[model samples]
Target: MSAPETIAVAMSGGVDSSAVAALLREQGHTLVGLTLQLWNQRRLAGHEGMPESVQGRCCSIDDVYDARRVAEHLGIPYYLVNQEERFENEVVKPFVSEYLAGRTPIPCTLCNNHLKFDALLITARQIGADRIATGHYARNHYDEARGRWILSRPADRSKDQTYFLFGLTQDQLAHTLFPLGEMTKPVVRQMAADAGLALAKKPDSQEICFIPGGDYSAFLAAYLEDVGEEQPDLSGELVSTAGEVLGKHAGIHTVTVGQRKGLGLTSPNPLYVLQIHPESHAVTVGSEAELMGTELYADRLNWISIAELTEPIRVEAKIRHRHEPAWATLSPAGEGLAHVVFDEPQRAITPGQSAIFFQGDEVVGGGWIVNRNS
Candidate 1:
């Protein structure tokens, strides 16, 4: 275990976060539960399919109550800080705009980077906390030989969350901790149950906390309407690699790289989404073969080890959130871009996504995915 430090745990009123606090408590770390109210409390009806108390999602009264209950049960101090304006500026607006521009953005990573880790970590420091920890199922290791903190896939490979953590800077990794990293999800649940924690039996949160019902497009539509902004004609052309027209699409936000079904297109065989040019508002479709990509370029590179990459490094690359990693040679281009040439032709390398590089179980670094080619 690392040196004993005062830890402020970010409790999301979920089993994972609750379990994290419980584990830290058992290990004798001082705990202060912290949750954020990221949206207006009144009129939550826009969020559908939530628990009775969630109203319309965002920071629901139910969530705050649950977090407070957990904190009290554990005999720890709790704080529900208001972060609505920050969330609006960083997470919500960017989500809507990305969809409008025709990309399936992963807002979880954005929230973790901007709101949860960065902003929340800053706030924790202001309160005299030594470090911030989360319930994420990824491990952070301090390698004395390398003098660095290494981000690695947890023992629970099935639940590894390194994909979303690629945005972390070296400094953040040094100060952050993940309590459930070495344990499997079932084991985590068992520990909570053994400890008689209420969250031990709680259902895992599946939908995005903010968009409960899961009609993200509708949420975006209504959100845009509230701001009195006219909806743009986000329609685009669906074509094949050879410039053959296939069908029409409502918007690029509705599709992503390697999407096979739900295209509303009927052909002789199954068709897949291969390319999305947001600039020209064109979506190229073809067979699964067309989705194969060999090269990827990324921006906003943040290296966890070696500080920077002056030459190509052999590592594993994961293009999307859930996809299995593939072997690749990663090279640092001039100024800041990292060029990833996959050993095998990967499929559906979408822009506006992330490409996380790994070395064995350790995360070397990653950045925003862009300039993909098949």
Candidate 2:
């Protein structure tokens, strides 16, 4: 028999990753469990509106303990790499900045693109591991005919995390592994039980690792105060689509597109946040119909199925994670930009969110949504 393949598993102390480590070890592979200490749960604790205890959230001390326990159960080496500084600079700062700019940002995508796939890959290599495996529900295969690594949606469409992973480059995909791509959540948990892993029944973490209670508004306030910075002067007038002043808003950072509640205005018709202008700090409120738009321009393009997008192509464009993919025509607008016109108008196509284009299950490319045609 030949030697086992050396693989490093990114253990999140969850059933999925624990099961992955056990399955690889069962295949006689040399396993090393690595858990990135992405954020300090106690950093913002005791701050106003911030949770004092962060036990159930992702990347907390409890999670690290669970990961270590799993590593010990498999008798594999485990290490917790402290990447708080890098994570803050790469993910947290950008999240706060994006929200302050009146845009809804996906920090998980930034964490995956900038930290997990990039920095973690480097760390895996440094430890003499051949490849890094994650618990993400996505798959990638090298297309010999196309000469590029093609990222595709996983078998479990319900657990598909491809939307946040659209920024993966060819090189990153080459070195990454998704063991849970084909396995359902239940099957993964059962596999962990078979492997004698204690976290087989552990609940999956649904909140962002850093933000306790999933309150971004409170987090923004506490985070900015912690950094000795004052919240931006976002006080402005709440205007209608026709430039009719409705009322005054506290700030642009306090609201998001498509939000219907907490507008502090009483009218016969319900008003929703249609737009937010960071420059003038004007919050636009209108009916839900005003939120729909057919065309959106995206910047910061990263192509996966092809080397570069040079012409118009038909694809399903997903504006946000939960939004359903809609048929659209994606064409090159200019340098580092793509124009997408959907067959149906999408609601709340906000900026700072990724626009992932898909051709069937395969991701063609994606970019940051910069603006929408009004």
Candidate 3:
């Protein structure tokens, strides 16, 4: 209970976040834990009537209790901040729409941009926190000579999370801290065990926070209240890029880029959904070879490398978070639009998905893909 430098750490009741809270305390920093309560999308599935326990999910009711328990164990003030409105607008809504539009939505990236980093960082400033820390497996370094923040990977390459964090702004980076980034998962768990923490040996949650049963289509049908949210009755035919009708589809949302199964159509060769035309409500199916695309256009660009975009920059392009970085040349299209041509063709470069850019391991910038060569 001694006076210490105030630092707010986001505690998700997970192994990593719990380790972060414990480490900050060891550093003699006054820790205040903040956990954002996001809407649970899994409730739309079979567990609809069963009360959600935060024990397994980040947004679940049981998770709040677990987070609070960790905070109390660490003897730090903990709070659950309701971010349901923002989460709905920024993450869940877009998630359902992207699927409905026949694209894969990366909810982790949305949560990073909207809830975890932006909203919570702003809240930290309001509460006069010196820094806001998280359990992300990404390292940050201040380039003393250039006087800028740099993002890099943690010791664990498999668990590295720099890709999901490309949307983080420089301002957000300035006030952020990652205590466990310097150590691998094993090391982190060891730290937690040494501190007598409860989640020292807990397995990481693998499923998306919102998709409990991993059946995305079913969850969307129940959560999305849009007039057409329920399976869209597509009166159009499923055609190939060569104008060949392969089959018929109920809705475009039921399929996504890079998808190949459950098409309900018999074919001599395996079929894959290459693209979706929302206007025509047509889900385009083609051979796997046709799914490759080299060039793409993106808008709503966010640059994290420096102050301004003076000219077309060369960096690694990412079709989505978790994808390996690939070399690309990007040119701005006046406003926020960006033209990115990858050195090599990437698979399923679908529209309505993000294409983040990185310089080496550090994320430089990114945007929403408006077009793809596919």
Candidate 4:
């Protein structure tokens, strides 16, 4: 028999990733545990409303220690790779920019696309490992008929992470493995316990790794202060759907589409943010019914199951991580762009979020949502 493969596992110090390390070790593969130190939780602590102390988040010092302990327990070589500069440039900077442009951004997807898969893959290869495994609940395989790598949803739908992984290229899929794809969260926790991992019952990290308290406004202020940058004055008018000015706002960066609260408006009927215009810095508010839309445009496309999108195709599109896949007609609008029209009006097709296309369990491709007016 050939010798076992030397696989580098991305251990995030969570139950899922630690369980992955244990499983691979049990299977007799040479494992190198790698934890990317993407953020310093204390960098902006106690600044601009940020909490002085934070815990239970990814990339924190505690997570690195936990990951190191797991590697030691599994008797595998572990390395904490520092990629803070790259993370800041690729994920944090873009996150702040997107918000400043009057759009909401998903930093987790940015991290997965730029750091976890892309940067970590390069680091893995530099260390003599041919393949890297992650705790993402997504499955991928090579399709002999289509001659392309296929990424699909995992067995545990609730834990599915394919939405964030839509940007993974075929090359990345070929060199990566998702061992927890077929296992549920409960089963993974059990496996960690069986392997004598101390963090078997550790809670999953929910908020953005760099942001504490899940407060985007505060994080933006704190990040700007930390970097010695002034917050841009994006303050503008809040207009009604028919072009009537309702009121003035502090800044567009503080609001998002589909938000109903903190508008500082007191009307007999409730109002919601229908759209945000970055050029004019105008936030448009209207009734909740106005939030529904049938069409959206997405750019920065990445195709997986198929080589490229040439013709209009029927797909179940997911506009957000928590959104159920809705029936939509996806068509190539221009080079590296797609136009989607859902059969039913989906609520709040926000710019800067991803629109991931799917045919059943398989991820067809995905792109970043763009404002229709843009």
Q: Which candidate is the best by lDDT?
A: 4
Question: Candidate 1, after superposition: displacement of residue 374 in Å?
Answer: 0.9
lDDT string for model 4 (144-207, tens) is 9999999999999999999999999899999998999999999999999999999998888887
lDDT of 1 by residue, 199-299 (tens): 68777666676665676766676677767788787788899889988889988777777888788898998999887887888998899877788998998
Candidate 3 lDDT, tens digit per residue, 214-292?
Answer: 6676566667543344455644678988888877876777677888988888889888888888788877888888888
**Cα RMSD for candidate 2?**
1.4
RMSD per candidate (Å) reads 2.5, 1.4, 3.1, 1.5
The TM-scores of all predictions, comma-separated, are 0.92, 0.98, 0.90, 0.98
**TM-score between model 1 and native:** 0.92
Worst 10 residues of 1 by lDDT: 43-52
Taking all chains together, the TM-score of candidate 3 against the true structure is 0.90
- Judge candidate 1 at residue 135 and give its lDDT: 85
* Model 4 regions more than 4 Å off: 1-3
Report the backbone clash tally of model 1.
Answer: 2
Give every collision pair in model 4.
none
Q: Compute the lDDT of residue 205 as modeled in candidate 4.
A: 84
RMSD of 3: 3.1
lDDT of 3 at 147: 72
Please report how far candidate 4 places residue 62 from its true position, in Å.
Answer: 1.0
Candidate 4, after superposition: displacement of residue 187 in Å? 0.5
- Against the hidden true structure, what lDDT does model 3 obtain? 0.78
lDDT for residue 244 in candidate 1, whole number 0-100: 86
